[model samples]
Target: MRTVAARTTALAAVVTAIGLLPWLSGKDPALSVLRARSAEQEATEEALTAIRDDLGLGSGPVALLGRWADGVVHGDLGVSWVSGTDVLPSVISGLGVSLGLMGASLAVALLLAAALSTATLVRGARGTLRGGAATGGAPAAMLASVPEFLLATVLLIALGVWLGWLPTSGWQGPSSLVLPALAMGVPAGGLLGRLVDDALPAVFGERWVGLWRTSGVTSRRIAFAALRRAVPAIVPQFGLVAVGLTGGAVAVETVFAVPGIGRAALGAAKAQDLPMIQGAVLVLLVLGLTAGALAHLVRVRLLGPGLRDAALALPSPPRMRAGRVARAVPVVLAGVLLVVIGWGLLRDPFTVEATARLAAPSWAHPMGTDGLGRDVLARLGHGAASTVGVALAVCLISYLFALTIGFLPAFSAGVADIANALPPVIAGILVAAVLGPGTVGASVAVALISWPPLAAHASALVQETRAAGFLTAQQAIGSTPRRILTRHILPAVAGPVARHAVLRLPGIALALASLGFLGLGAQPPAPEWGLLLDESRAYVERAPWAALAPAAALALLAGFAVSLSAWAGAGPRGAAAPAKAVS
Candidate 1:
């Protein structure tokens, strides 16, 4: 009870702090409002001062927070500067749409996870359970690696363009939900499936399972029992997956033109609407925290206190070695990327072919032509460098930042945690609003947002490694702290850090793509994948190949990054390895 009370108090404090972020950021809210209204720059200083005073910007933080909290408790969410309407109603309407999408996606993910788990668990005696689990897990890992936008693009092309099976965009009926849900759910499902697979074997190995088997329990009954026991352990993980999916929905909603909170947030961010941005972020934070709390309660209720701890303490499953095909995947992907970049550099990607506008695949143009008669293949080839380059840059910068600050003490660690809690999309929007849109803005945004989680992970590992026996021995021998870190700790943590860097590439790529799609990255005439998709949206039906080509390239690149990470042994097994062993 005391713990719960402490947590509640902490949550309230954090939420209050978050609510004050916009004011504390040092951004001029009056200027933001004026910009939204497109007010003339020559407007007198008197006008600015009047606007600021009207908004009560002169008030102290405590007073402002108290007023905001009072209004919130009375069901008010302030008024939007852009729309001139009460924020609560619009937020509520947007929340309903987002909730529907999230709920559907969550249900689909859980079902898919269950099905995948069952398939792996029911493998025949002829196959080794380890091999079966690995085989089953590989697909999910690959899926999880693919960014949501890339997945959404591919599904849009395959189902909407090629097969004509579903609407390409918009939120009209049940059919529209299918593609978006799959896009959002598949990666999450893949992750959850792997979690279930890992937990089931441990549960089946319990002494109670042996007793049940000795007492003539059927195999089906035993499997059912194991699943029931495993679920509580998996529930907490589901919260994390849900949070990620919700964040990714910003891109998904944009791609599909869904009128959800994500879409509203994007618009609000673009317009620098402080009220809407604050309201959207607050709602999302509340939902994520509530879901996490509920999942914890469920776990405590279902497993009891002692068993839940035991389940969490179970040894992680064995690491599976990458097979021959897995090893060759990165090589093949790298070669293809090189070919595209080389081809792009040698030829003019912007050359027009007015005579063959909207042309299908042929000897003249392999990937056909867009509405503007530009070769899709050439555009994709050129875009490859920008897409892949931004991803690489973000990954390198973020990793370097992580390594540098992550080795620092608790102050840096606390800052990292706070930064990590800010969603990447929101960060990108804020950066773009301040810096103005371009590759530089997008890259900086992504790197800033991506570094926090990596820093937190690396810091924890460094702290753990510092406490190991070898480090202690070095310290006892009068070794300098710098030398100890450089010679011993650095090498110990390098593998995990490298793995994290690789794993983070796909997400960085997705973030860049999302920004580009929103016109905040790689401005006009630049062959960026997201920009290409954005430009081609109006002509999708007329020249589907233009969008399809870049979408496929992005998907392939994301997949390759994922495969490379997996091949490097950066999966759950590697992450869960003991720090003592590394030392």
Candidate 2:
């Protein structure tokens, strides 16, 4: 009953929010429909009324919400506000493919994560990578920083265009799904890998492993045991990855021209097909919710009642000072990124020169010109401001908001799950509906969904710290809960949370890039990295640098930010017992 209620509430919230789009945007439903259906149609009062009456847009909020809710319940996703086609069948046709793609991508993610995690754990047996998620430094973050769209684009160019190895576009049998799956799965694997890699150390640090080792247990056997114990704890994170894949599909499908629900939703949004949008989102929501629930169940079952009940404090992972090599990587990368960003700050990325369009790289034009004949170097330089600069700003804002919310563990974690399950693209769609497509809306959309993770982390650390002897000592002295949290608990949690925020830079930047690629962020004349990649698509074969420049720059910047974050972890460890870890 509780599960049903939560699901229903989530459904209702989504339906209500989408139904209020027109009113919230202050746009006339009828006029918007008229323009979407026929730009040539004159918006006469009679025609407007006819459209309102036909589409039932004349109804009030209550009626509209009720209608959408009923429709969703009945599997009658209504007719497209433009096409008048039943949205259920339209959505279902592609939803199957998307689901299939999602499954394959998830499998690929698990495989990659297991491999990477195994390698990381084994390698770190002597040093750096064993402690926590942030400890892997650049590799995982760099992988995550490479957005799905960018990955898909590169694969398309290399495998499809250059080598003629696989089918480049379309959902033509199983062969077509490979690249798209990799595109979506690689980053997910990187994310999952970091979680598992950093977590197993805590299990390894357990007394049982050390006890078994002394009792003649082989290292391999002990490692396996540690993995089993650690995995269930982080199982819920896989659900977040599942949700992330659905979002990734949106951009991946667009790049690959796959007939997935993501592409359907994108088309529907462009055409203002309201019912189609609702139907697509509903499908995504159901799948995401279902995946999250299943992951939770898996965690519960794997642990069973014994571990779940017997489990002591879920100690927050420790942050150790990185080794010299680990510390150097980020510094080098940051210096390179800083140079690129600084150079970009001074260049002009907007001036067009048709004669030099698609120009090859030369002394006169270092990075060459783009499809529009705009200097690539200038755009590369200036685009850094929007992409890298905004990402940094968003991270700072999200961290601040998360810190405030962290004191309430239950609320913060729940919201984090919901936000994680709901794709950032969903937020982008909502923001676009409310404020139109632009960088600011996209940035706000990214910020809106990105903070929950940090909040949940902070909350977890807070709870863990609350159980520590020191906080109890404070309470015994009559310290108020607020003062305890602000003065003691938050300060301890702050160091770990700050490191997380730094590590999050690459992913946030990647999200912004994905939005831009989907046309939900920056439009043309804006040299935002994703937008630049999108515009470069037409002439990619003729001038590969147009695409390569930004892609390379993205990886460079992402690696730099992440490496910097990891390197910075070498600072003062936390003050509390659970707040910091050495190995």
Candidate 3:
């Protein structure tokens, strides 16, 4: 009861702080607008003349405030700042589109993650390659390192241009959701994969599972039942990932030119349209808070106390008997393939004319030109570099920040929990607003926003790992906590951290690309995948390939990242205590 009381107090305090932000930010603009009104009133003779003339309401400022207050209190949401239409209608319509997109994307991502996790878990002890190499976590981490725009860009081009299926940009029908949904789902899917990868192994290794199997429970039944039990553990991570998806939605909305709140906010920010900005932010804040609360409720209800414990347990797989050479060959081949692909793509951009014209079905400009007429091949090549580069950069930067934030609490548990509570979204928005828009701004935003979960995971890991035998032994031998952590704990925790990074990478990439595509990041002539798609906006009807190229690129890159993350690392250790080892 006391703990609940304390937690409630903390939540209230956080809410108060968040509510205060707009008022503080509004002061400058309010003062400027009001001061101008004062001057106008002085210049004129009427009591409310200046207010009416300047604000277009023919009413006093106090009257406007009264109306706003009444509407807000009653949940009316008031009128649109631009069209003077009912704000509730606008919000409803826009939310419908946005929610539809979000809902579909979430569904697809969850499904894909579940499937991949099931596949990996079913692979079992024979899963080991040469040197008893760990699998899923490594790929998940790698994929998490890549960005979303790259996936979207690559897929858009391949599907729209090569396959003649799915429009590159803009909503034509239900199909319009496909590209954007893919963009959103790819990253979410990757994160889900990591969650499942972490969860399933523990389920496989349970001693009770073998006992159940001996008692006539089929292997499939054991796996399914264990998975059912693990669902509660997965919910909390899903909540964390959902936060990222919400932030990334702004970019996604802009890329497809969808009439969602995110795009509205982007327009408002660019125009410095105060009312619109305020309205959009209010909606987002409400939505975010609601989602977060629901997620928390779900986590508590489903996971209970053992939720975190289950997540940290490691599974002991049955030993593999595959020949060292055979295992080494697949790993080596995979590594070589990655190296070659990375090297080639990095060396030069992909160009339609140079790389695809003769081979592809001929049309005007054959493989087609981007907004700048750069070879699609070259643009794609560079786009791949940029897409993957930014994704990797965001993943690394965000993870590092998370690590720092997470560890700061090691010396004081209270401080760590407080740090965890600090809102990353608020920090990100403030930083982006101050820095102005661009790749740098987006990078900074991603770094700021992506840190919280990373911090949460890191804090949990550190708290647990600090007590492990190796750390105690090192301390007994006179090693510093830092030294012990750096040597033993860091190595052990690295794989899980990498998985987190993978799960996050695609979302960061998508956010950055959406910013670029919306003209918030890279501008024209930069050949960015998102920017490239943006440029083709005018040609949507004449040469849709122009837009499709970049979109495809973004999608493909995101998909690959998801795939890689699923194939990569091991589950979290210590953060969640596992069931006893299965013999």
Tell me, by lDDT, which candidate is best.
2
Residue pairs whose backbone atoms clash in candidate 1:
none
Q: Rank the candidates by lDDT, best first.
A: 2, 1, 3
Could you tell me how far off, in angstroms, the CA of residue 110 lies in candidate 2 after the best superposition?
A: 1.9
Report the C-alpha lDDT of model 1 over 139-247, residue by residue, as the tens digit: 7666666667667777877788889899878889889899999888887787788777666666655578668867887777777766777788677666667666667
Evaluate candidate 3 by giving its C-alpha RMSD to the native, one decimal: 8.2
* Top TM-score prediction, candidate number: 2
* Decoy 1 TM-score against native: 0.86
User: Candidate 2: lDDT of 109?
Assistant: 84
Cα error, residue 389 of model 1, in Å, equals 3.0
Give the least accurate 10-residue stretch of model 1, judged by summed lDDT: 574-583
TM-score preference between candidates 1 and 2, better one: 2
- The candidates, ranked best first by TM-score, are 2, 1, 3
For model 2, how does the per-residue alpha-carbon lDDT over 276-350 read when each residue is reduced to its tens digit?
A: 777887788778778877877888788878876444334556667678998788778778877866766676788
RMSD of each: 4.4, 4.5, 8.2
lDDT of all the models against the reference?
0.71, 0.75, 0.56
